[model samples]
Target: MLGRTMYALISLSDLENDFINPYDLTTRLNRFVAVEYGAQFVLTAALLFTGKWFLGVAQLLLTAFLLHSWSVRQHVVDATDVFRQLPLQKKRRLIMFGAFLFCFVMVTYRLIESIIHGLLTDEGRETAKKLFQDAAASLHHY
Candidate 1:
């Protein structure tokens, strides 16, 4: 699932050129902003719900700035242009590798966190369970 999400992010990046019709600048900008902002917002909300409030707010602010910053946007566009110059097969391979790396890192991170929690928080077991329940309930906003 994480790999799929990473693939979507890579494929939907503004750097990916049209194998079909050309997209206008406005359309490209809108799509990029929507995807970047939407993903960041969801990530921020998830982090906050899972009890990482500071990290969530910091990420939210940073991503908000990235969304608004013309320089950052142009930098991404430039990076994507470079990526677009790659051969199709190479591009596919790179994206797949990226997805795998992301998935592995995320899974490992979560596993480590779970292990640490298990070792350190025996008294908070019930609290953790309630927190997860609340987090799941919050997802109904979708």
Candidate 2:
């Protein structure tokens, strides 16, 4: 469902650029963003409800990723506005750095979240307790 909505939005965007329908274009774009937000919201809710602590962390990181992507898109547009003023090589380098930074942050966030989840969750504590009890019982037998 999300994929189909995204595809339809992309198709409508292409059509808008080829032709001209300012009103419909704006409406379509708004709907697209709303749908994306809805999908994110649903995923987050699922994570919270299912006791999937890792998934919650991942969802938070994904939100950051989306924000970073938005920032990069804005930066690219701003760079284009000063195309003649800025050096082409410098602009290219900045864009590449932005892309790399975005990905790096996303991956780092995921890893950190995963580690934190493993360390802090009740499930981990319960597992540790069971392991300790099992080991103690074995030692007593010996």
Candidate 1 wrong stretches, greater than 4 Å: 1-33, 70-107, 116-142
**Alpha-carbon RMSD, candidate 2:** 12.6
Task: Give the per-residue Cα lDDT of candidate 1 at 92.
Answer: 41
lDDT of 1: 0.53
For residues 1-142, write the lDDT of model 2, one tens digit per residue.
3343344345444543566344444454345554665666676678668886765666666656556655665222232243342353244334434544554576589788778666766987788778879999999887
Q: lDDT score of model 2?
A: 0.53
lDDT, residue 97, candidate 2: 41
State each candidate's clash count: 0, 0
Q: For model 1, how does the per-residue alpha-carbon lDDT over 26-50 read when each residue is reduced to its tens digit?
A: 2443445456556656876887799
Model 2, residue 102: distance off in Å is 16
Looking at candidate 1, what is the lDDT of residue 29? 31
